[model samples]
Target: GRKRTFLACVTWFSVLMVLCAAAPGPEFFAVVRFLAGIGLGGVMPLAAAFTTEFAPRDRAAVAYVIMQSGYPVGGVAASLLAKWIIPEFSWHWMYLIAALPLITVLPAAWRWLPESAEEQSVAASREERRDAARAGLRAIFAPGIRTTTVMFWVMSFCSLLFVYGANTWLPTLMQDDGRGFSSSLNFLLCFNLGAIVGGIAAGWAADRWGSKIVVTASFLVGALAVLAFSGADGTALLLVLAAVAGYGAVATQTLINGWVTRSYPAQARTTGVGWSLGIGRIGGIVGPSVTGWIVSATSGGTAAFLLFAAVGVVGALVAGVVRHAAR
Candidate 1:
């Protein structure tokens, strides 16, 4: 059933994200993105859970960041396609061509994916597993950690809200400030370019400075960048601000994920990270929806940007206040 679940979700995930290949127009593309977001909502967090679960304990943070770094890498690829592929062929081709890799990944997953060794061992040792499972549940709620977990959850919620909101609306936000469609597209490219750099920088900084410090600063900087973008109507200025926003929002999120991975031992790491993501997805769901509403209601994207910028502030404060609860 685990394999079946993985197969089903992965298949849908791959199919959905790439289906933009066939999109007819703006409305259809938006619908495709919606459906793809649904599949992605399932696959991405689970993939992170698996990576952290199997990684060596000492290097779980590195493993988590490295695994998740694919997110921004993919963003960079999409931005490149928007530049080169879309012009050469179409956005449809861009999506379809990128899906080519799944030809290998799907079959490899089917043939080789297995429960991690620890999970397999837990399956074999029933009594020990029962005991460990109970303690794992308790560990999350035992005083200090309970506070940290709650703070982490709140921070995750706010961070994702900011990430998804800007990611979905940044183009429109730029255009609303009088930039042409071309400049808006260029902003997306610069934003994702910033994301790729942010991913690398976050990993390096987290390792040297600690996930908490990196995450806190990421949120803080992201907040300022986003707030500043409201006034950055100049094309070059806006592009630079977009990159800062990407660094702050996207990089901060990966570091928070790394934090979740590091906070718990192997026994509960999957549950910890998975649940944190699951619950935080409340914000993920709300983000784009609310942004759409605000943009429509106000007839501009300025309000949406400011609202989400304030969300970045909340995330920064939460990350700053939480005491580390690693066990």
Candidate 2:
């Protein structure tokens, strides 16, 4: 069933991406992009749940983190692709490039991806499926788990806020810090490169130690990076800070996702991960907008970085407070 849902979401996202490429006007493009967001949103938690289900119990967190690394990897790829494609072809071609997953990943996934045992059981009985769904929802809120769920939600919100806000504003912030135009862009690249490396590192560390301490430390590391960014003087130092910030923000999100996968059982995994992400998506929506306002109001100074760094602290505290999984 999750395989079916994953395939449907891929199809939905791919089709909408195609529509976005062919959009006639700004309004049409906006509407189609919003619809595509729905597809993109569904793909994430489902993928996380799927990864956790198939991975060995002890290795699930690492596997999920490795999978999550693809997000930043994709970001790096897009940045490179855009650099090449936009000059030669156009922006529309970029969307067309995104739509290629329809022909590539979709068909490959359909051919190779297997449904989990849990999914197969539900598929055989509709009443059992309904009961499982209800049970999963119930389990997330049951007693000891409810507090963990809420704290996870808060951590997700703060992590996403750090992620989106930094990714959207890092370039501008770098420029404000006196870097040249090209160097500003380079910082963004370093940032994502950091995320790619940091995510994998955090993953292995999480598998070795556990998600709780690793996630907490990673968030604090990111906050320090963000705070140090305000006073960064040399280009080399600024770039290093950017990379660290990326590690702190992006990799922490990866760890959080992994923790969710390791925390919930197969029956409730998707529901738990999906709702946490659903709430985090709201923070994602707010992040860029709030940063834009801060930039406009404060001119992307120390105050902006301070505020974001504070959010990172909040995320660390929230992660620290998440109790052991109830079930």
Candidate 3:
């Protein structure tokens, strides 16, 4: 229900953008963008929950990897489509073209996806629903869970800070470091390619060993990669480090989500995952702001890289505590 509501709102807002953009005014475009952002904010967590719920027990990690890869794959497709269309059609047509996939997918989603079984079960029992809701709130503060919750929160903060900050500003950083446009785009492609590989590999490792070890190693290695990337002066080295960081950075969240799903029972899994991501969104906001400030205050690329690398280290340490708590 909530997810559907979010999608409806986004669809409406997307239409508004088209109409507003047609008018050609900054304020209108700004308002439309804000609306679009609200829609985006609601979709991601819901999608994560949906993925976990639908995924089979044995292949949960693989499911997450495949589901998360959609973002990069869609991005690549959109870029190609835009390149082909933008020369012949107006920019508005590009937006319209993007809407085609949503039209096809939304109908399939409406027909196929099941309501969350946990939610449905809760609804069937009024007393149980109340008790469960109370317990859900208390679980985050319970003796066994309090530390785990805090650890995950800290991990989320650092992980998102690095992920969003690096992705948002890295291209500009590359250009500042004297790389050409083609080289920077190549770096992005390499980075996303690594992400696809990393997601699958991390999932397999987590399922085989444990989410803890996979997450911890990912953060530590990711931190090192980011630090090395800070001094990358050559195109080859920069692309290599970007790919490594992408592998580590992108897979960290998937592993963390898997951990969350396994740590809590099905009844509260959605709440746990939702709350963690909600908290992490704050980090997502802070990352870009902090990076922008660092760029203004110092050398843009290097300072931002160092800040993100430091964040990765903090995430690695916190993830250890989370692993302990889970055990």
Candidate 4:
């Protein structure tokens, strides 16, 4: 079921991406992109649930972080690709390139990606399967599960706020510090690269110790790194802080995803993950807009980063409050 859902999402988004490239006007493009977003949104939770279902139980975090590492890897690659593509051709070409996954990844996925283990275990009538799904959705809010669900929402919100806020503002913040365009862009690369490497390391740490301690510490590290951005001695130091902040923001979210996936009953896992992400996206939606207002109302990048750092602190606290699940 997850495989089928995943493939359909991929196909839906891919076709819309091509339409985006050919849009006759901004209004048309915006509507098509919104439709495409529906497809893109479904893919992530299913992918997480699918991967979690198949992972060795003890190594769920490791499997998840490995899968999630693809996001930053793709981010790093896209930054490089966009630098060339936008300058050489136009922004439209970038959309065309995104659509290439239809031809490339979709076929491979259709042939190979397996249904989630939970889905396979329940070979039943359609009504029975639907009933199971509905029960799973309701289970997330039942008794002991309800508190953790709310805490996960808080953690998810703060984590995404850190992620989108920094991503939307990092380069512009760097430029505000009197750096050139080329130098500013380098921060984005370092940011994503940090997430890729740091995320894997954090995953290993999560497996060894636990997700709770590592996630809280990562948020604190991000907060400290972001606060230090204003006082860094030079570009080199700033770059290092950017990397740490990336680890704090992006890598923390990846860990949260892993934790969310592993925390739920197999039947309710996708519903749990989906709801967490759905709620968290509101923070993502707010981050860029709020940071934009902060930057505009304030004098420099310092204020914006400071606000982001404060949000990271809140994230750390929220993460700390999460009760660990019993084995």
- Backbone collisions counted per model: 0, 0, 0, 0
| Alpha-carbon local distance difference test for all models | 0.75, 0.85, 0.72, 0.86
Give the higher-TM-score candidate: 2 or 3. Answer: 2
- Model 3 lDDT per residue over 1-327, tens place: 435654675576556556554647778767776666665656555666677777887777778777877665654465455555756785666656645535765666677767776666655576876777677667666777877877887777788787778777776777777776555556667676777788788888876777777888999888889899877667778788888888777768767766775566556665677678778878988998899899989966777878877888888888776644332
TM-score of each: 0.82, 0.95, 0.85, 0.96
| Candidate 2 residue runs with Cα over 4 Å from true position | 176-181
- Colliding residue pairs in candidate 1: none
Which candidate's lDDT is highest? 4
Residue-level lDDT for 183 in candidate 2: 67
Model 1, position 110, has a per-residue lDDT of: 79
Clashes of 3: 0
lDDT of candidate 2 over 1-327, digit per residue (tens): 788889999999999998999999999999999999999999998998889878876776678878888888877887677667877888899898889889988999999988878767654688878888898899889887888988889998998988898888877777776775566778878888899898888888888888899999999999999899888788888889988999998989988987886687678889999999999988898998988888899866677788789999999998888778423
Q: Provide the lDDT at 277 for model 3.
A: 72
- Tens-place lDDT per residue, model 1, 173-221, is 7777777666777887777777678767777777767787788888888
Model 1: number of backbone collisions: 0
Over 4 Å off in model 1, which ranges?
A: 1-8, 16-39, 53-59, 83-101, 110-115, 125-143
Question: Candidate 4 lDDT (Cα, whole model)?
Answer: 0.86
Colliding pairs, model 4: none
Clashing pairs in 2: none
